[model samples]
Target: MRLGLIKLDHQQVSLAISKLDERAGEWALKCSTSVDLAFPTWESLKSQSLQAFSPPNQAYRVRSRFLSTRQGCLTCLRQSM
Candidate 1:
């Protein structure tokens, strides 16, 4: 199995993929990419409400809130609850 991590900031987007080691129950990084985006595009996305996005699953939504708290995204953490 594979897991993806995406980080979006005002200036850029970063993506990382990790593959699961079933035997060890660990994840290893497989690939990553980072790209700077246009300010206008970022602004458009940043301005949108979180309500516009829905988690694909309840587990993902719970993890998303936990990660948001760890990352110091208090607003996002609060909104996710």
Candidate 2:
């Protein structure tokens, strides 16, 4: 997917999306007064979110909190109390 950020009047911005191949890699294109680039997403958003907590201490804390909430949600879904 391609995401373009366009500048409008008085500091306003706009986003444009286009479909493209992931293997094509990243791209930068000039649009009038601004440059636009394509942002790529991995296969799993959850894995991406987990990776965002980089520092060991922070990652541990966040992982614990996320796992607890995820477990609760799974239990609720399974109607297992």
Candidate 3:
């Protein structure tokens, strides 16, 4: 089950987990960011990266992958820079 979902602005987003407290069982969370790698540099690349990911499994761990444009997205917004 999902706990919380909040969206800010300009690709700013946050997520929260609840319910399954620390007493329920073992749970692990992971976050990943993907960027374009067309340019000489992965960030400078004037392209978008689309990747495939697998779902979280209880037998292994729970991980979430998202983009992070909060830090000004400077690195990713360079484009032709």
Candidate 4:
């Protein structure tokens, strides 16, 4: 299945789309943002990204206080997808 990967580092967050290789138990990165996101831009990016990167019947793993702030967004995104 395809997976959304959100990586949080000090003052920035990185987003990536990956495909999980069930047989190999590995994740292969498909695409990612070139720019790292700070708090000021995280919201817009998160919404736009979730919509664009998230497809139906897939999973996500977001790691960051920034993303965590909007739990409903994540849940809704999952259900919508």
Candidate 5:
């Protein structure tokens, strides 16, 4: 799965994950921004794999913080399960 994050505003960010399609040569939507943050098709997440070459400076920190928080929450949830 191909994951992405887009900063919408100061308080919001749009996060998504799509399936890689070799035939279509584009990502197919697997899941989108949701409260549960579910991605059924997601296999593994690597730090380097998520990095962007050149991203908007203003949104970088916001996105990073959001993702970091989400990752922490996910880790907690998994441990509880």
Candidate 6:
């Protein structure tokens, strides 16, 4: 993706992977790619800068609220009721 030879949007890649799953009703599909041995190591991974993005605390709170609501967790649901 970083090389840009075969560009794919995030959602497109995710959907393709979901379809590749045997549980998603497409059993025969599979992903294949040849990664060069020269590719960067996992320990060298670094996140993209997001100075413009919202703070971590704000994002964590939002996700927590959403999971609490949608997943019907015992504690969260009990608290809400």
By TM-score, who's the top model here? 4
**Number of the candidate with higher TM-score, 3 or 4:** 4
lDDT of 1 at 3: 21
Judged by TM-score relative to the true structure, which candidate is superior, 1 or 6?
6
lDDT of 1 by residue, 10-35 (tens): 22322111122453112111221222
Please identify model 6 stretches exceeding 4 Å from their true place: 1-46, 70-81
Q: TM-score: which is higher, 3 or 6? A: 6
Model 3, 1-81: lDDT tens digits are 232232332121112222224522122122223211122332222121212123335224422212223245454334325
Judged by lDDT against the true structure, how good is candidate 1? 0.35
For candidate 3, list the clashing residue pairs, or say none.
39-45
Q: Order of candidates by TM-score, top first? A: 4, 6, 2, 5, 1, 3
Candidate 6, poorest ten consecutive residues by summed lDDT: 43-52
* Candidate 2: pairs in clash: none
lDDT of 3: 0.26
List the RMSD of every prediction in angstroms.
Answer: 13.9, 12.2, 18.9, 14.2, 16.5, 14.1
Comparing candidate 5 with candidate 6, which one achieves the higher TM-score? 6
Those runs of model 4 whose alpha carbons end farther than 4 Å from true positions after fitting are 1-10, 14-40, 56-81
TM-score per candidate: 0.18, 0.21, 0.14, 0.23, 0.20, 0.22
Write model 6 residue lDDT over 38-63, tens digit each, in one string: 11322211121132234768778987
Winner by TM-score between candidate 6 and candidate 2: 6
What lDDT would each prediction earn against the true structure? 0.35, 0.35, 0.26, 0.38, 0.35, 0.38
Clashing pairs in 6: none
- Show the colliding residue pairs in model 1: none
Candidate 1 matches the true fold with a TM-score of 0.18
Q: Is candidate 3 or candidate 6 better by lDDT?
A: 6
